[model samples]
Target: MPTLKLAIADDHELFRKGFISMLSNVPDFEFVLEAANGQELLDKMPGHQPDIVLMDLQMPVMDGMQATEVLFEQYPTIKVIVVSMYDEDRFIIHMLEKGVHGYLLKDTTPDEVEKAIRRVADEGFYYSDFVSRVMHRKMVNRLPANKHPFFPNATNVGLSNREQEVLQLLCDGLSTSEISDKLFISSRTVEGHRLRILEKTGTKNTAAAVAYAYKNHLI
Candidate 1:
């Protein structure tokens, strides 16, 4: 079986090592890079090409929030799952805003960590039940912001029926191939719809696209 390259960014050495050790025996999992902080993570990522990253928020050199924004702009292909101790509503809401594929508490189970890795790897997102419930409540209570001319017309965005279908499936966390199988369409066709949805909604990645769908009540 092909290996899945993984990386972790954390300031705590003991925790970093322990986290890696916990998953050391998982099949097909390989650690290609490790970083003490977010800046270090960015510095090491270019040559390593990890498929996914387990990020921590409170790093010394550069925090996860900054790194996440940079990663979103720089490495759109690399998925990130924030594994932090903080579960404050603001922290959770902001991470989702920054486009992480998943979020997990640092105290979560190794099984959950492994499962989250596999889920994000296969589905492009894995918002566990906890995160889902928190996000839904927060989004519901969010106050309406001033409308700005710079924002894409998310509410007014028009999508073909097929594109709408694809967006809904994406919001459901179905990856390209999964959507292909479910919809009986080619992967390339699914990708095409994915791109058009991003363009129409002004989102850069699937995570952001799903966020857009939620923020705009699209799905």
Candidate 2:
């Protein structure tokens, strides 16, 4: 097997060093870049291009989300498998939707990590086809309750008609106060609906929520 070039972008020195040390025993992985943050990773990508990146979610200068967005937009060829401590469905779905190949927790065994890396490198995915099917089928339309897999919990709490109206106006570039005025509701209520939307869609902010709405054909 061809040795796969690898890179890891994490803030903790111990984790990075330890992970590299662990992988040293495995000849399939060759560490080419060890970045302290997302910016460093991107800055070094021009020279040290790895076949796959093990990205961390939380870092100081330029977070993993921002870097992942840039990677998905710019370095479309490089596979990214998020290796973080967060195993929540929200975080997993968040990274997966942003074009990452996989999401693994920080404490996962080295063998599992290597398996995930190899799967991503060879098959262009770490999970089974079920996940891909779920993503494509559910994200393309507003599914009814109990109609999906990755977001089983989220789909159970489908958006209300009022919430859909709020989302449409938000997509139309209306501010919270403006939406409140147009809908004859308080700004607080509109803000509350926005938060709920974000929570349900596993989005970080209004922009992400709007993107999710467009992806799901909600707006």
Which candidate number would show the highest lDDT if scored against the true structure?
1
The residue ranges of model 1 lying beyond 4 angstroms of the native Cα positions read 142-155, 174-189
Per-residue CA lDDT of model 1 for 79-160, tens digit only, reads 9999999988778867876778888998898888999899888767787767776766665665443443443343568888
Cα lDDT tens digits, model 2, 1-104, are: 89899999999999999999998789778999999999999999987899999999999999899998997677878888888888555576666657676667
What are the TM-scores, per candidate, against the unseen true structure? 0.82, 0.61
What are the clashing pairs of model 2? none
Worst 10 residues of 2 by lDDT: 127-136
| Alpha-carbon lDDT, every model | 0.83, 0.75
Alpha-carbon deviation at 30 in model 2, angstroms: 0.5
